[model samples]
Target: MYGWIWRHLPGNAWLRALISLVLTLAVVYVLFQYVFPWAEPLLPFNDVTVNDQ
Candidate 1:
């Protein structure tokens, strides 16, 4: 399946790179703005506190 996708996508390297970058950014935006915030409180690191004495 992966090989078929690679073969059929495009012959232009730049175009493929650009499309991959756009898709990555879109996924990151959705994760940060929606998914991450919703799941933040459940993360173990969320309870860490800083103490300056």
Candidate 2:
């Protein structure tokens, strides 16, 4: 998969590196801004816990 992306990206080494960095940051930004928030409630990572009564 990574090889596929690396191949699909245009340009030589320097430009490819820059574009790859930008694409990575954009993916992270989208996940944090949209996907993570939407899935937050469904995740079990909150600080709260309940003891069986």
Report the Cα lDDT for candidate 1: 0.80
TM per model?
A: 0.63, 0.80
List, in order, the clash count of every candidate structure. 0, 0
Q: What is candidate 2's CA lDDT for residue 19? A: 98
Q: For residues 1-53, could you state the per-residue lDDT of candidate 2 as single tens digits?
A: 98999998999989999999999999999999999999999988886888999
Positional deviation of 40 in candidate 2, in angstroms? 0.5
RMSD of 1: 3.5
C-alpha lDDT score of every prediction, in listed order: 0.80, 0.94
Clash list (residue pairs), candidate 1: none
- Per-candidate RMSD vs. true structure? 3.5, 2.6
Stretches off by above 4 angstroms in model 2 are 50-53
Worst 10 residues of 1 by lDDT: 2-11
Question: Residue 27 CA error for candidate 2 (Å)?
Answer: 0.3
